[model samples]
Target: MSSNFTNTYTIHMLCANKYEDILTQFSSPIEIEDLWLAALTEWCHSPTAQCNLGTNVPPNSRIACTDPWYSKLRWITLGYHYQWSERVYNESKVGEFPSLLYGTTVNIINFLKHLIEGREISSNNSSRLLEQCQNYTPEASIVNYYRTKTTMGFHSDDAEVDKEAPLVSISFGPTALFLLETSEAIKHEFDAPLHGSFDHVLPIYLHHGDVVIMAGKSRLARHAVPLIFFDDDTEVVSKGALRVSHNVCDKIVKEDHNEGVCIHCQECLTYIRTTRINMNIRQVMPVHR
Candidate 1:
């Protein structure tokens, strides 16, 4: 199994060694492995369901959107009903989500603030002056979704994010394959060679306890889930498990109101997007005149 995951084949496991050194410390797969994110899974799954995260499509919408950036990403469009978005985004966001899950986004966002901080940050009322960004143009949150059996088109991380920002994410429920294709050339050079190799098509086997770190050129590198299979692996599936992950990125944008979420959004509610949680964790800088 170790050899199958070497640099020669799929993604170079930057965290494999990190994971190996500590994976066994726990009794079972626990979110705590990823520390902050682990706690989040428990927090999100809890009854409170306070959420700053959500999938763009319907809970059962079989639609899959392709990456406007790549074609291999098309392969990930399986089980996905369609592969596009038609709504225009606007200025107001963070107040309404899922419409089905309205009022919950705020709780989730506040929770994120608390997560980033070392200490606790209670809601507005109990603020011990722990922290406050009290007023800031909310970074337009552009969210898409991946459903069970749905594939994410292959392409580099989103373009909305400016260069030099880390993509923080959160995952919840249902296991899926996350593929990161990094060939020898692409690994080090953008124009070195357009070699099509599965070397980077790494399926991030996520299940509850998983965190994806996207930064540097690696952040610019291509990634996606070409396909989703139940019991995709007899070994892992027979045990009855699924992968879920979500996170925040360090990117900010003004809701165009003219160009709504391109992948998944309110007008596209009937999308039937899966129930996976994705968030952004990045430092936002105000635009300079």
Candidate 2:
């Protein structure tokens, strides 16, 4: 749960602790933990309902498209479904998401904004990136689950129409090595080592309950999660692992668990007891009718 950054784009890392902090704080319904649990429960059950490239894929299409972990976490659209072109459609072709998911989306959006207020966002596009986030309301969320083997290629999240808004990312489970490219040049350095030239790239170790907000110039900058270290493999596993195994990790973790501390539970501990989950929430402007 270490955080580092230069004066370029502002990357705020919230909750520099393990997943146990997330489970404890978010377990209470009064603290909006129920919203996160509800969203996770709905997606795990509705395996085929995750968002895709939105071609001719039907509402019940099982095609995972580009994302292999789509079954664990799907795109839950509140107002519209996002297309491959980065635009959104008002039609509920992919069907609407649950109320709990929508509520959780809003909560994350506001939390991100609040966490990075007044922070300078290095952006040549416009100077008001942080200003825009002040009033931003996210309508779409890309929920993702990851195993030790899963690796995300370098990419920027510029699909939303409102590019001014920041991206809110929440991490759970094992620690991960996250990469951020500072240069405007788009380089797919997925194979590069964790540490790149300090001038161009910054490396971060993201742990469970760590919240990252990429706003302003950093919002559009290229980033990726190149490596994930699961708890089972690491010498020291987060205390949250015990909570997840015991079925006391709130509603979502319990629902995903089986009888006792079963290792087969995908939510509890799959992929040799090393599973990670991330929620990337963004704002998609609705097309004016």
Candidate 3:
């Protein structure tokens, strides 16, 4: 977990045992987590299903699934839905955070504490690190889907009130080139000439099952995803790995169809092949100490 960047740790292949399970939960047609996706036909009738697209569609408009909305899908919020325009989380537009995701985040935080304790650090430092790990709460998440050519620009996640809590980022699918820079370093670079070099930005390669934790001093660091490697060997989903309930499968296919037929799983695998999914989880509120 050692990293060149202070307070930034990288755990390679962190979710080896449960990677497939995590992917199935998100990629399967049966949505396990309550995702607030824009223009999703199933949620069109709900009051919280306001579309984020810059289209002329009414607030409660019911757009057909046949439209090319899926291709336009980029990101979706979970639990506390973030208002992108305002860069804030609305308390009223909140939902239950996924149990599986919450458990995984807690485990990672505990593991981080264990790693710190094993180091030859002072007792005071070790105690402070343990306290930070124990105080984290997974309150919200943003699931971002990236195509091969897609890229995220440099930005700092400063909307969350709980700055001390670490921001855990989990990656799936092909590897990506992630650039990270400290807030102070970014400010100094901005003062330089227009064509000045950016030598302080650290490039991190995030692969499938990799986890990045931004905590302590690096909590508000500016970061971006400049590129994603199109690796054919990247395992998106295994055959028969997705466990769809019988009732849910029935809704996907005809009642008289073959017993083992599952079109949903096939479509899910195909979509994941060319897409990279990143689950960025964080605490939106201060911990009541």
Candidate 4:
């Protein structure tokens, strides 16, 4: 990551209670449109949400959905909100985790369990896997939005209270160059006290719909998104939109009740052409603790 390039982003936090109080804090207070409020409340019992749209902008300025602020949104946090500056999850800021995301993550973990047990996932014997996933609860998520020239610096996800649980990451939109490195490799590159191997670094190309699991010994491995390949191809974007448009439309429809007010798939196609979205989910609390 370039030290000179400032990381611009916004955070949408799910707050189950005090929805009205939180909204009042915004300089130019905005309501959580009815549809979104309903969806959030239904999925996580969060009646309100909080959004921090960077420090550079005027706090009292009313931000429209089509404003430049939306494009600058880099990340959103759900469930237990993470304090980036402090590198810790605020226990008091917790909210109910989204069920849909949790279910999807559980399914992914089940597949991983089958691989570990030396069983074919297609064998349809998921009873054992389902039982194992019962222990994994997704308490937090970081949704990263990457635009052109956006990059994530090398870092380890050690803020969670439980480091043993697997970390799941889902990718969408354009492809990105993901770099995974060992702790020793990071030390060597930074010229830290211990001499480490540079060979431990691995570069991976992640395309849309790809899932990455960091578990076992690699749970806290250092990783980074060094680059994103934004393909301006219309066909590619259209296909990509088709893959996620239903979910997007569903959410939008729930947020607005207007009979004809709906975001078309074509709008999603246009958005896909310029960005990549990554959903990084993790269990922030220890099950045994």
Candidate 5:
């Protein structure tokens, strides 16, 4: 924790409009048929999912999604009840030893408490990119997703958390294609490029180590996940194109009064033990009234 986020890059971005400085304050934008400018290809997987999932095909694979299974903001079935993640659904909480590999890479919960109450909280530094999320209300339990050729569909991050505040997303795995649109672009039209003059549609190659922050006016802006590509037009450049990341959230599931008591029988008890990893960082604010 201390080592991972000992630096103030995340808090700096939160307080400062550094992200806006990148796209707006910068000069002309350049496009290419053989280069990835937005994709930051850096190696920062502590215990790497590849090492965990064994680079398998079906049951061994995993999807690090940020939205629930039913949120259809961008006309996609994101935040809904779906039987995804074998390890998660099977009540298998692997990775017991808390190495600098997984678990809330960059924690915003401590940072917010530090800001508001001048308190210092400890965290882990597993090279997980910090995505600081803030809001004017409470948040639901977070969720995860991995958008490849299949699995999850096009959707928005606003489904799990409150729709008022913006979502701070960070890319952590292989490079994948992402499409972000607006309400006007996908209000009622067909799936033809999500038409609209105000379309912020982007086929972002969310490569490893890259952090794409969507906030402010673009927070509620409708977005979607399109697809990913392996090779470009010609020669093969690099070989890191599997986009995997988690949105750290402030949502925590408080157990019922049952606490240590078992509510269901042994069969049901064996089921609801393990939970899905919906690591999303949410900005929670107290009620004014």
Candidate 6:
């Protein structure tokens, strides 16, 4: 933990002249991705259903996602009942998580507290969030597994009773395109691409071990993932496309030259080529509050 490098990076300033600072690339010595994958397989057994958002899909569509199923993970949010809901219906108590998962959750929470105290978050909403984060004890998590073709629409996480707490997102496997936009972008009709001149969208390339803390005003900021780089367009140059890298964390291939993907992470990257895993840990305060 002491050897980690955490800092604030501003994507861009909004029209209100307020700069949104996101905590990105907060590194840690522990193999976070490995822990995430292990917990994913151990906890989330039995294939679940895909997100049925009432979108039309042709019966003969060849896309793998046309017949999609559940690829996301959760902490104590088991059972087929609350699949799409934000927080676990009956939130697990503290220390109820597996040894590895609990440790990781606490480590992240502490890191966030330190980050907020050390830096100055610009938005008033975030400043208030920092106060909640200090005393925040997370009860559940929603971990989503995604293939290259998987894409989630623009939306905000506002279900928790304690809306001030930020959403902590960790990425594992190949990089993907993450989009963040202003509240103005939340319209009745969602166009895949931003239309007109006023569409305020910022595209971010989230890579393995990359941690994004969406707190403060950024928490309410509408965001989504439109595309993922599952193929070798970015990795292969002279040679033809390479097979997916090994999935295990420690195992590394000798010939991966991607700029961001590191050798230590290649084991998981190569194996989980067309897919990614995301763990979003959050605190859901008591209902009475």
Which candidate number has the best lDDT? 3
Q: State the displacement of the C-alpha of residue 161, model 4, in Å, after optimal TM-score superposition.
A: 0.7
Over the stretch 235-284, how does candidate 2's per-residue lDDT look in tens digits? 22333344344432333345534444443333443432455667777666
Q: What TM-score does model 4 achieve against the real structure?
A: 0.64
Per-prediction TM-score: 0.38, 0.60, 0.66, 0.64, 0.34, 0.60
Better of 2 and 6 by TM-score: 2
Q: How accurate is candidate 3 locally (lDDT)?
A: 0.56
Error of 3 at 221 (Å): 0.6
Which scores greater on TM-score, model 2 or model 3?
3
| lDDT of candidate 5 over 206-260, digit per residue (tens) | 4333334444444554545445333321111111111111101112123522223
- 277 in model 1: Cα distance from truth in Å? 4.2
Candidate 6: which pairs clash?
73-143, 126-216, 244-270, 245-270, 245-271, 246-267, 246-271
Which scores higher on TM-score, 4 or 6?
A: 4
Clashing pairs in 3: none
Quote the lDDT for 161 in model 5. 24
Residues 42-112 of candidate 4 have per-residue lDDT tens digits of 32223322334533332322222234765776766778988878999988988666676777677667656
Q: What are the runs in model 2 whose C-alpha is more than 4 Å off?
A: 1-40, 46-48, 51-79, 84-94, 97-127, 184-198, 231-273, 286-289
Clashes of 4: 3
**lDDT of the structure predicted as candidate 1:** 0.32
Residue-level lDDT for 217 in candidate 1 = 40
| Regions more than 4 Å wrong, model 5 | 1-148, 159-161, 183-200, 230-280, 283-289
Better of 3 and 5 by lDDT: 3
After superposition on all C-alphas, the RMSD of every candidate to the true structure, in Å, is 16.2, 8.7, 8.9, 13.4, 18.0, 9.4
For each candidate, what is the lDDT? Answer: 0.32, 0.50, 0.56, 0.55, 0.27, 0.49
Ranking of all candidate structures by their lDDT, best first: 3, 4, 2, 6, 1, 5
